[model samples]
Target: MQSQILPSRAALVDRIALQFEYGQNLIVLLGTSGLGKSYLLETFITDKYNDFNKAFVQVGAQMTDVQLMTQLLEQSFNAPLIDHNLSLSQNYYQLAKQQQCGACLWVIDGGRHLSEELIAELELLSKSAPNVLYIMIASQSKLPFKEVVNIHLEPLNLVESKQLMGWYFT
Candidate 1:
């Protein structure tokens, strides 16, 4: 398969891989529109951790905290097994306690659309959960939580832009 990791993004990809390798569980990828935040998330997961059980969820504009959490939990685990009676946090806590899920990675896209409250909650869960890594691709840089690995992406420079274009047109 052709590589999704572009020439300009190689360094960023390497840095992220290093961070994840060294036990960086909670990562927030912050970048402006058109900077390939979502693309980077997908590439990083697929290229680096394809063996992991993944829940790729897009956060919609009107989605509530409960909706977001349920979607992640349901996708990560089979919905039929999850206890709908329990609150979302309780359900998440229960799953973490099970310790049966090995190497689960959640890639949450469209994070800028969600409220900061929801983002903070997700960060907390990611920090607390074992064997689960959360990478949120967002334009927003300000996070309620302090202990997070924030990887910011920048637009490619003119030379690098030409190199990226060369990969497509050559």
Candidate 2:
């Protein structure tokens, strides 16, 4: 993701921006619930990216691999997965490599809930597609993948929360 330093948006966002500046393909935002993982991801995307090809998927508990790709197809490519003829892997890869397709970004919330199939496919996509970037907001603290740049967001303390509220109401 291309970026430029701008207005104040917390140190966390700035850190992630630096990671993007390093040209990493996959970045995982790790934080517990209520730590605003989703907020950070959305804010980062909003502040930095201006591209039209971006996929935003919220991973549900029961989501299947097909469901995952279906959302990606719908959001980024505007190509719904109606045909049962092709596998999810083939469909996304074909669309992603299309001559008309621009650089794509995938922002997945609750990424820890993703199934193994989804994870495997994502790794494959990252390897094959040079124009795609993925940001996964997960609550786990582990950095299992050596290729994934992990950014951990700490929860706000009580006083910090009060300070934030003050900033909000001012």
Candidate 3:
């Protein structure tokens, strides 16, 4: 189960591991559908920390900007209704700031479904939070954040794919 077919990618994985260990604030994983981006992120997060404060948000096809922001805020804060008065965007930014202060790893999946406003807010948070790690999984690169280490995930090579299949199918 523990094998990798893309022997050339060993260096890439090592680089990513080093960045994570050195406290890089943002890591962007980009690839097409069915590339196992989510699986890789999940495996890395789970392997990294037992009690990691990880938040997962899957953007729906019909999700609006407000809805996306609210979902992100809710998941990050663990609060069902966070401030009824503030707008969804406002609440989301606030929650992101708070999470960054707490040094939590925020994983945003399906970010391509988010609206422009949500993306802007995420860019702002990425800039402001030095300690907060934001891992974004998207079909392509569209992040407005600067200095984001982008990893273009391809299908695992033969050896790695076989290992993954065996691990899951067994």
Candidate 4:
């Protein structure tokens, strides 16, 4: 498969990998749309495929907190359905704690759409499972917590942009 090698993107991926290697749990990627955030994340995931059991959740503006949480629980753990909020979160935390996957990575794209409550639930997950990593792909929206390491992605430079366009057209 072919890939676009942009310096900013490569650097962002390196920074994220280094942080995870050093035991950081929450890493946020912030950039405007079309900044290659998803592509960078895909590259990172592919490179770390052997080290983590990764789950990618694409957040949409229409999804509610319950829906988002349910999607995550189903995708990552497949735990039984539970109605109560606390029970649902606890179940997810328990499964994360028991994860045998060398490390578990939860990558949420379009994370700006996630409600504050859902974000809090993610924070709870980080607290419960130190072996798990949360990579949130946000556009302009700031993370609520101060603890998260926010990596801002810059748009492609003239040369990189021309190369990308040339590759796309040719």
The candidate that wins on lDDT is: 1
Q: For candidate 4, report its TM-score.
A: 0.83
Per-candidate RMSD, Å: 2.6, 4.1, 4.3, 2.6
| lDDT of candidate 3 over 20-55, digit per residue (tens) | 677565677788888766655665556544445666
What's the TM-score of each model vs. the native? 0.82, 0.78, 0.69, 0.83
Local accuracy of candidate 1 as per-residue lDDT tens digits, 88-161: 55677788676466677778787777676666666676677655565545555545656788778888889877
Candidate 2 lDDT over 31-50, as tens digits, reads 77877777766765575567
Tens-digit per-residue lDDT, 1-170, candidate 4: 32566676677677787887686777788888888877776775566645556677778888777776666666665454545556445767566556543466777788888777777767766666545555445546777865677888787889889877987797
Candidate 4 Cα lDDT to native: 0.68
Candidate 1: 10-residue stretch with minimal lDDT: 134-143
**Local distance difference test, per candidate?**
0.71, 0.67, 0.62, 0.68
Error of 2 at 81 (Å): 5.2
Which residue pairs in model 2 clash with each other? Answer: none
Ranking by lDDT: 1, 4, 2, 3
TM-score of 3: 0.69
Q: What does the lDDT read for residue 25 in candidate 1?
A: 73
